[model samples]
Target chain A: MEQRRSFLKMIGLSVLGTIIGRAIIGREMLWLMLSKLTKVQAAEAPKQYGMVIDLRRCIGCHACSMACKLENNQPTGLVDGELETPNRRINWSIVLGREDGEQEKGKYPLLSKRFLPRTCMHCIDPPCTKVCPVDATYRRPEDGIVVVNYDRCIGCRYCMSACPYGARYFNWKKPDLGRPENPQVPVRPVGVVEKCTFCKHRIERGLEPACVETCLGRARIFGELSDPNSKVSKLIRERGAFRLLEDYDTKPSWYYLPW
Target chain B: MTNIEDVILNQLTKTTKRFYAFIGALLVMVAWGAFAWSIQLTRGLAVTGMNIPVYWGVYISNFVFLIGISHAGIAISAAVRLLRLELYRPLTRMAELLTIISLMLAAMNIVFDLGRPDRVLNMVFFADLSSPLVWDFISVSTYFILSTAYLFLGMREDLSRLADRLPGRRWLYKALSAGWSGSEQQRFGQERVLRWMAIIILPVMVSVHTTVAWIFGLQIAKPIWHESGLGPYFVTGAIVSGISMVTVIAWILRRLLGWGKFFTLEIFRGLGNFLRAVLLIYAYFMIAEQVTIRYGGESASLEVLEFYSTGAYAPYFWSFVILGTVIPFLILCIPRTRSIGGIVLASILVTVFMWVKRVIIIIPALMHPVLPPGIGMSTGIYAPTWVEWSILGGSYALGALLYTIFMKFFPIIDLEIGK
Candidate 1:
């Protein structure tokens, strides 16, 4: 009788404990949700670096891509006298070419080709920073430039999956640099993710990003987005520029002027 | 000695040539796997077939599948004890054993997938609370510890009983038993503790799988993976796969150990009925998922659906439907074919194809990224390398070795209870 009574008492206590525990956790989660909703307002940085690309002026010379590779000291895509597959190559910026009216099946005479230079958008609200299991990737609070701490990344690649633009690249193998690596950029070890940093090193030193500087047609423009007087702001306002995948609400700092 | 003990404990006292051969083969596979891992660590993830876009492949699928299998043991054991399902009492210990071994393997697969395994501790030291992976880490580890304690506590009486009989390992058993003397007071205390643990562990198990699903589901980047229904869908799939694994393992032990009396056909029949109902629920989830994706008509999701229905993954997707779901469901439904042999074959099919389903879920969605494949880039077709296959095979071999060694030391059939 006593054993049964104790068992019942124990069961009752456990039930009560569970209810109390759940209530506390529930309240904490509610508080967290509320806190996150309010924290978005606090993300307004003073000097928001941004880019404005003019598609009409782009010549598709691939100079920006080359310049980016040289500036970042990325892999050369050469292994044992063989060019590595394009998928295996680490490219931070590339110009994508497609027939503009192909989706509508426009007639050959009316159809026109276009080039879209793609890179990390450096969103004001970055999904990559949120999904990183460690704080290896984060947005710089002062300048609003998203960057990765390569030394701290565990190579889980959750950030890669979170980026909607397919902007992130994983170092599959030890990077083989055929030329003398630039002393300015750190040669990231294999296994961590890498992407365009808006040439943060160059920007910090008061110089344009390599891609912006080396564009053959001067299609790429760079300046402070936070300042209304900045060249990027004036171009965006005058040209009626648009961001990619605006539906995603990432608020990309990068913009493009249509041809 | 009672007839039950004589039959069940016979294998502990004796060794056979076949057993030695089996252990040898398993060790070879494990060694091969270790060698492959060493190569991967040195050469980097280049050894695998993974690249950009399809950044994850076989390793992640194996991790999910193994974790799915780990859920059945504790769930079934807890349900049996808590709900007074006496017919399932015989299967509890083996189910719990499977949970421990498979959970270990699942955790190992995560490490195997890591690019820098040496820096894994950074997940804890520099943890991000908002990340779903951290939630998965915490929940899975909590489940592991709780289940381990639950398994050990339940084995106390059996361990104490075996200590006196097995003179060679008397000290080991005595230490493990922790002076469990079968007193009324002790039994009452133990029962209360176990009951509480069962209640606590059930929620943790659900959270573990849900968090795993959230790792993909929360990513708005992938249209197919980002869905509100993913949490329940993953939980249902986990239960189905876990139950199938338990059925297969239980049948194998029944044959190998010659414990036909303990693992009766009636027990299998009950399990079959239970599995059939769960399988139906799982089938419902699959249909609901497909219907929602198709009807929503989101372009990215449509592309993923197209990839599964009529694209590169069509063969694998249909195979899972026919072999894993439909055929097994048909076999389990028919009264004549729901016998022990039929159940085992159906279970084997379900277990194998469920893994195929996981691969299909992970790889195809990745292959069809929202953005188009840019200039000069290949359309990201993934094929696992020999090293990956070898490691996968080695993980199973290691699991089998653990189970085999455990059977040698302990009573796998729970001799103290339901006698």
Candidate 2:
């Protein structure tokens, strides 16, 4: 038994040594790769556009989500063909109901309900883009918006696994646009990943996203975040906005002004 | 003329009516699975029960499981070479065949999991080297090629001996043997090559499973998969499940083919003891993995751990513990239950439960809500459809069929005439 313990001790030490050794080597390799990549990307400095949502003005009406679906040609019903369950539907702009503190404490309702509208954060170092084995998803250098090349996407769903925000959605089946199709956005084929593109098609046409344009409460704000004069930047400066899951280091373009 | 040759050849040349029936059943399954894949190809991934949050299910689970199973062969074969255990000589070729067949099935499982099988070529045309999936692809393919080469190289002496005796398959044997005349120089070259290949294979096998683990482990997005310990944890699981699988296969072959004299009690006993030690180590890893998540203050990992322990996944979690590890460990540990039959039974339990273990690993981590506690973003849970189940069953049958065909064509057990 004593001999077995010593043997196990030896093996553990060796394994620990190997892990530490590999980590050091791996760090060095990562540094070298980052250096080389930064030099190549430095040629074209891109504009970083972002959004800021002030929760104080939101009414939980889901107007932004509807506008997004109308603009993007997303399917109306659940892909599984379930009824009245909008949660399982292809929603590019999801409006979630949030509550603060303990629930069910005294019948008078201590907790307050808040509506949180979630769109693609369009992260600067997007996890989805980083893990796409086929480079189908990429962050455009012209603007900081992450986009998916539908033609190149093999739909391996590795990006879905890597995404912290759960923003990416797969085209599970052929899309059925309930309303008349919007001419601006191209309908994505089945078997490719689709997400909120910050309405890149509209952005290129010098128009704000449909969600921002159609917000009944005017809670959504969008502009060039890197520019100090932009509305998003002004809001961030005035309200001290924060990104969701910031600890993940995704550097999301979207921010929220908490009440 | 030799006793070894006569006995092995007799089994190789003959087959029962049951063998044909078994092959026929497997072929029908393969055809049905191919039809199911076509349906999936025409329709999208919605055909499967996968939805938001639970996007991966049985396909990915089976992929990881088969990859783990493949490790048994090369790991054992390489260990035998390193330790100079002549007792394992008879089992080496069978193990190598298992590795090759399982790997092929694992790759196919990946194809089944893909939303667009046609665009698979895009993985190569525009590859992202930083992605762990790319690392998985590169390592697994490299392992496959090396194992195939190693298997053939090890079989050269046997192939040469059988080339003249098997007159109908002479050309195939001759081509495979690579014109070996059994000279001393040729023998020396084979030894040197085999030794180097064995050395190379060991690390490659380790890296292959580690890379597969990294596909999940590198993701900080999911709390359950993003542990630094996952790499070693997966490797340990692979070795444990692999040895258990090999034990089952070896026992079945011994009983059915009447190769009991060649296999011997000592060989099964050695394998059983080795399996027991590996089980102990795996149990230690499982405990360490659980303790770190359960006791640690990381809320995200804690939520996942809680989910596994007492929430929706509790049934699979507890069953995996009792049947997969604990019971098997006890059975293999006790001298009374350490017989050949006992070991085979334990192996069967471990093998099935390891697969169940993988399904447990993939689902709960994914099902956990990505949003913070306050936000209610409920999504559907995964339940694999008939298409998935059919394809999974077909994949295992295909692997067994391949093994059976290979056994018929070649002398899987080494003669040990020259060695």
Candidate 3:
């Protein structure tokens, strides 16, 4: 009888301890969420924004690559070789990968490889922002554009790992310095993570991203798909294009079509 | 009395030499690994075998395996304390030690893969508090602390004994035990607190390994990793591999430290049953993952499934399935086949195979493209450079060295332990 009483007493104490610990953690989380709510309102722009990629005409020119580098100054190479290249630069925004459906240089040797000019898809259901413990990165409700607040970012790489798209990059070295410095993308510090923004700076200024503006072949498309009357909505409807990785349901803002 | 003094004097004299030699050996290997990492660090990631199609490789796989192995220590320690399983008494302290050492190394391996280890502190400062990785950091640390405390408490009465008797390091043990007073009331309090820690540690252990599975599973990149099954799979894998590690190490220690009477063939048989059950569970999950992917027939999922069953990963995959699962299960299931040496061999094999399976889980998914065809979203194939292997070697050596140092100071197989 005495042992039974003591066991019950122990259970009561443990339950009380756990509840107190949880209450403290819960309170801190609530405070963080509230502080984030009052700080910025990217939602003021519009909801349901997206992008469409024109697959056929992409010449792999890497102009989008240059624009991103000129803008953000991301690290030159993950691990650059000791030797030098003619450009002495590495491509961050531009990469050579097989088309989602094509094979090359074998029995069907003549089949052409397409240039994707890949960047962050900026999903409507952004997993990266959702998993950000510090509220350092968030999606603006007004336009549904995801953005990162660098000052608040603690380079834990949780965002880096959470991103399923492989879109995010870390500034392993110091952020690139001495770019012509378009204010579209901010240069990151060595420790914090970075990625291809949908150009929130350009969006705030009520303009398209510099890459969308500067596309020679005009392969990239950006606009508010929510406003069906918006140019992006019209183009998406007319051209029969789609967002990348739709099955995963990230609801990316970027779309591509093979021209 | 003179004979006892002579023995004590001899052990004391050997301490510094053994300590230096052990540390020197580990440091040399660490330096070698550091040099290799430097090469990979200096060269662009292009130096690796990775090209557009396969992104993750051996390094990431090893990371997952090591982290999984790290969990067994805590699991065993917690299980013993929670159920009051007296059979587990002899094993708990070593199990707790394994937990701390293995987990620290596992955490280090994750950081080692980062392009910038120098920026690691940012996770402490600027980490996304919401991300599972952040949760992983918190849970692993919590487990580390709890496991360490559980270890100390189990040995507290013993530490106090040493403090009272040993003159040279009376102060050290005194400090460690925190002036433990052995009133009957104190004994009761210690037991109560330990029971509490043991209960708390169970869910935390499950969360930590399952969170690792979530890291890849939640990612949309690899269809193989995207399944909900990964959590259960990882937790089971951790327990099985962890038990195997403890068994092998325990067997070895029994021979080396003259601790045969305590460890016993019966203890080995109990561990054998433990490994066999988990391995069968592991096999069931493996088949489930393959069947789901195969029957679903999504080209991407099929590709990963086919790759899992009979692709580039086939050799290692079969090796893992056979050596880690089938062979051990075969031996351990039959009582006649079960011997101390046989169980030890099986344990060692399971540990290595569990690591290989993790490598397969990590690398193959990166092999498949996530975006639409002709969109150029494919990852490149990557082979770990020599530097990665060196760091891995350094990590294992470091883990063993930590265990060695602890053994040198305290009698790990002391009669009162696990009691």
Candidate 4:
């Protein structure tokens, strides 16, 4: 035990010595990798892009869900490994809410619940992307979406717990599929996890997400928020929309409004 | 008296029938579980009752619980050994055994949550270095590897002594012994490695559990998962729960294998004291976790927190607190109550109760969905599919199988067996 302690001291001194030596040398590999790269001198930086979802226009029809399923070949109700109870179907499940105590006078109770279509919240501060040990899950570079590279996941389900909104799902069993499946959203295998991508497939092909196009209620809205004239931008400017679990500071792209 | 030469020759003997019978039972369970998993594969997550509202279910909870159970190895091998507590000498082997098997079991159990196990390697092929799950993979795999090597080195000297008696297995002993002649230098070198490993393993094992908690702690999910207490609290609960599992196994091994002569009452008394300490620490943390959650903005969490106190999953929750915490502490801490019988009972309770605790922690939070625009909270009640249950049963069988095989190849009680 005494010898081991001495060995630790020796290692510690060497590490300190190395650090001091590097400091005296001005710039080391550390400077190149840690400091200088982000200075924007030698490297060209692409846009840090994202999408905005307007909750006010969504109807509960699940056009986005069906589109994602057809596009991604997502089995009816499973993502990652978790199995869904029937009738609780989702990929992008929809929720409708109303303020309490609004009595339906006569023909009034037939109002459509305010549709809130949800999938991966795609938070600016993504906790789900940080906890995957094998790096099977990550935030994509071109876009700010935390996507699962199903082939690499060791099936630990660490990301499942990290997402506050229950956005991620695991492939607990082998995923079912039709042959020559949708080329865009690859049906994942059992033992990996998957989640919503804001219809990255359609977005990649220069098309609006199936959900955005399919919304008969026009409640589902998606677009680049950076282009101030975008429809999503126009709506957000007109009505103050908010994300879920705002206190966590996840800075989600999906937002809801009372209108 | 036998010569020193004769003493070293005894380990060659093959394992007896009792070992085979034990392993046979475990194999049957593994087979059943694998079959169930296959069924789950053909069908989808639809086989299980999990849904949008209650997304995670039994499988995720079991994964956490089993990892906690694996903490027994560090508590026994590192803690007791570091203190130079001689009572742990006879039991260290089994505890180490428990760690290796439990780690494997916990890793595999995650499959119950995977949509695609085939692509599990995507983590390696095109990986994301920034993910917490990635860190979890690296940490757990490291723990698994280090523990295995440590166990191997620790058992080397003993295996050397059992060589000649091993009959047809002299070469097996020779390889493990690295031709150890039990010289003072060899003992000193082995001891050096063991001590180093124990020192490093203590932190590694603790970190492993903490990382497991981080898998949930990092989540923005609910009050239960998103707490500062999630890390240390989980580590404490795991160690406490783990010791009891070790105690139960020790008791069973002593009785079934006629190991009583070496697994003495002194060891039992020492284990009792140690387990009591574990339980006390656990109780303190359990209370701290609950109190902190209750006081914090538990309601605002994406998942419900207070629901645990009165919702559908309440019994499993309270019972876990009682069984894993209250009862075990009360039994083990009392002076007159710290008997072998008391310890054994508490051990059994902690193991079973802590499992219930794991379920409550995982399911209730998951069940309390943060409803979306069109989605109403489906009354999230999930009864695990038959495949899920079978896989769980199979896991227990896998553990038992490994233990039995280990005993067959390596004698259950050695060195002090006949003394």
Candidate 5:
């Protein structure tokens, strides 16, 4: 009878404990949700760095992509002498040939082409940063640029799955730089994620990104979106630019001016 | 000695040639897997087949599948305890042991998948409250500890009974028994404790799989994986796969230990009925997930479905449907095929197919390529390398070796409780 009574008492205590525990966790979750809402609201201010791309001026050249490879010191091919596969290759910016998918009608020798140069949009509200377990990836408070600390990364690839744009790249093998390392850019080791930093190093030194500098058409524009006087702000306001996958509400810094 | 004690305790002393050979083969497989893992660690993830879009591959699938299989032991034990099902008492020990072993393997698979296994300690030092990976880490580890304690506590009575039989290990057994003299009060207290544990562990089991599902389901970026149904879907699938595993393992133990009296034909049929019901629910979840994806009119979802139906992963998807679910369901449903032998065969098929189903579930969704056509690669595929396959083989061998070694030391079937 005593044992049964103790068992019932224990059950009561456990039930109460679980309820109290759940209430605390529930309150914390509600607080987190509220804070996240406010954080999203705060992110809408125009104080962050951003970029604008003019598609009409992009002449289907691979200059930006080439410059990104050289600037970041990314591997050109795998160690086995074969060119890196498109899915596995680590490129900060990749140029997609318009001929692959954007073949429009009316092609009687008057063929026009348009290339889409893709890079990390540096989202103001980054899902990748939120999902990273170790805080290895985070959006900088000052600029809202999503950056990865390669040294702290455990290579779980959870961030890779969270990025909607497929912007993240995993270092599958030892990063075999085809050329000598650039002393300016920090060299990342193997077994970590890497992506475009919006030329944060150069930005700190008061210079434009390598891709923006080397663009043959001067199509890639980089500036502070927060400042109304900045060139990017004037371009976005005057030309009516649009961001990719606006439905996701990531608020990408990179905007496109349609042809 | 009583006939019950004789039958249960006799099997522990006999180490036959076949047992030695079986354990030897398992050791070889484990060695091969270790060698493969070393190569992976030394050469980076390049040794595996994983790439950018399909960043997660066979290792993650194995982790999910093994974890799913681990659920069977606890779910069964808890159900038996809660419902007062005397027929299942003999299975509790083996089931709990299976849970512990499989959970360890599941955790090991995560280590194998990591690009830098050395930095896993960072998860402990720098735990994030928001990340689902952290949730998974906490839930799985907690479940492991709780289940181990539960298993050990339940073993006290059996250990006490067998303490005097083995003179060399008597002290170990006595210590493990922990001063339980089998008085009325002790038995009463132990029963109460077991009952409470049964009540407690069921939700933990549910939470473990739900958190695992959240690791994928909460990712809004991945179309097929981002779904509300993932929690219940993973749990239901875990139960189905777990029951199938228990059925297969119980059958093997019945044959090996010659415990025909304890694990009768009726017990097998009872388990088969339970598996059939769980499989039906699992099939419903599959339909609900696919139908929701199809009706939602999301291009990414449609693209993933197309990949499963007619594209690269079509073969695996269809085989999972036919071999994993439909065939096993039919076998269990038919009266002629519901016998012990038929049930065992059906269970073997179900267990094997469940692993394949996990692979099918993981790969196609990943290969859908969410990146826009102008930016990233249009198509990506993953085929596991020999290193991955070898490691997979090694994990299975390790599981078998653990079970074999455990059987030698302890009583797999509790004669004191089960009549």
Candidate 6:
């Protein structure tokens, strides 16, 4: 009788221990889930900023690219009147020109040319932010704007490899801005990766991004993408715009209107 | 029978002129590498050939190769112990020592590749769990600690035995032995602990290589790198490279230390056959990976495939297959050519070309981006600068130096196996 009672007591203790462990673990898991859910909810709070580029109106002039460079105080690739290699330069916004013979429109004699103005798409589910080892890059929860914490970056460049659009650039050397520095924008140090931030500073101050503001063709539009009545949202809903690499399902906030 | 203990003790005590020359050469290479690194630190990574698109280059490839080589311990020592393969008993210490040295070198390569080496500690303070790089850091560090402990514990008995005999290094041995007297109770406890460590280390080894693979595989940006089979592929490749390294090291030790009796022809043949089998499995994975990409016919992945098979990188890709896999396989397969010298030669080729394989894995993927480069953008050219090469050479010399120094102080072959 005594032996049986001891065995029963042992089983009771183990069961009680298991229950307590389960309760604690379950509570922690619940807290984690709740915290993640709240972050998602906050991200979806209808203030998500985005951009739309109407390719039909684009003239391939590269005014916006120049504006971005000047605004960001980016290196110009010119050193002692000798142009540095393209890889050595940093351009947050670039106009990619696809020349004739690549995509012939009607026949061999007639060829079509297309100009693609590329920048950081600022995706809702960003691959670059996900791959940062130091949590240096992240999508802001409030406005869904992706940003990089330059101070925290270890400059491993995993984010550079993770970006599908090739939007990110690394500061290989010290910035040699021949022009005066932009006091509004902090110059990135050598060795850290930098990218287009959708002009987070300008947007926060109710000013449009330099690229959008300086676009001579009026091709670029910036507004709240989540708001149904916003210009970018209306352009997407009405004109059937497409995001680049749609098959990847990154859910990029930036869209382009077909020519 | 030859007294193995006396032979090892003699090797430890005696310092030959040739050994000093070898160590001297290694130190010079190390110094050159340090000089190159100093230049890089002052100027920046711009001194290296890594440009806009090809942000990673030889350093990353060397990092992966060294990590793969570090698996020698897991493949030879721990697995041999678990399987009770007594033929490989003499090789366990050498393999473990290689693991420690190569792992340290591999980690240094990461530091070398970093843009901001000063901010490396930020990885710990601001670690992001979602990143595959963090996973790799965690797993590699865990494996390093565990393997170091495992190696130390396995050497405890030998250290205790050497403590009494070697007066000059008595304190060092005594401290390392940790009061081990080889008693019945202590032996039992030690055996149990080592057994548990061996078993536990296997998974950590698998996790280490798997996480390394995920560093590329998890990226949806690079279609060629984003493969489900990458984990298993990298692990199998690591084992093949690791075993090849052990074979090469065993051959060197036999030639230099005159330990031909300990590392006999049978051991070489066994290793050769084992390497052949793993190489075949690795070939299967390679075929499967290529076939899946070709059949799927995705534009980006096919571009990457074409880049390997017929595009700009075709030479490297074909050479890796023919030299690293085919010739080695054939050498290991033919019984007549499976002699000790032939096996060693084949191992050297495999070891060298495995590094080339890692290069093929990294560079080609970056060269072929999903979106083509714009008109004014870089054409994605990469060539490692003198600085990069110097640093790489230095790392290899450093590894050799560490291995040689350790062998001078301790037994390269386990002393208590047959006893």
- Per-residue lDDT for A139-182 in model 4, tens only? 66656666777656665555765676777766545556534587
Q: Which candidate is the best by lDDT?
A: 1
**Top model number, DockQ:** 1
TM-scores, all models, native as reference? 0.94, 0.91, 0.83, 0.84, 0.94, 0.94
Clashing pairs in 6: none
CA displacement after TM-score superposition, residue B127 of candidate 6 (Å): 0.9
Model 2, A1-259: lDDT tens digits are 9558856987899999978877988977767656533212222336888999998888778888878988899886643353223333577888755454432223445544467788889887777776788888988888988899999888888888788877888887766665678887889888888899999999999999999999998999889987889888989989989998999888888999987
Q: DockQ ranking from best to worst? A: 1, 6, 5, 2, 4, 3
Q: How close to the true structure is residue B125 of candidate 5, measured as C-alpha lDDT? A: 85
Q: Which RMSD does model 3 reach against the true structure?
A: 5.2
What's the TM-score of chain B for every model shown?
Answer: 0.98, 0.96, 0.90, 0.91, 0.97, 0.98
Candidate 1 C-alpha lDDT tens digits along A68-177 = 99999887565422324577788899876444443233467875456789899999988888888888999999999999999999999899989998889898878888
lDDT of 5 by residue, B215-266 (tens): 9988878778888889999999898888889888889988888788878899
lDDT of 6 by residue, B167-226 (tens): 889999999999999999999888877877898888999999998999999888998888
Task: Write the residue-wise lDDT of candidate 3 on A143-231 in tens digits.
Answer: 77677776666544556555656666544344445435555466665445567667777777888876777788887778777888987
Give the alpha-carbon lDDT of every model.
Answer: 0.88, 0.83, 0.70, 0.69, 0.85, 0.87
TM-score for candidate 5: 0.94
TM-score between candidate 6 and the true structure: 0.94
Give each prediction's DockQ, rounded to 2 decimals. 0.58, 0.41, 0.27, 0.40, 0.53, 0.54
The residue-level lDDT of candidate 3 at B396 comes to 83
What residue runs in model 5 are displaced by over 4 Å at the alpha carbon?
Answer: A1-46, A78-86, A97-99, A103-106, B373-378
lDDT tens digits, residues B234-303, model 2? 9988988888888888998998887787677788888888888888888898898888887785888888
Clashes, model 5: 1
Off by over 4 Å in 1: A1-42, A79-83, A98-112
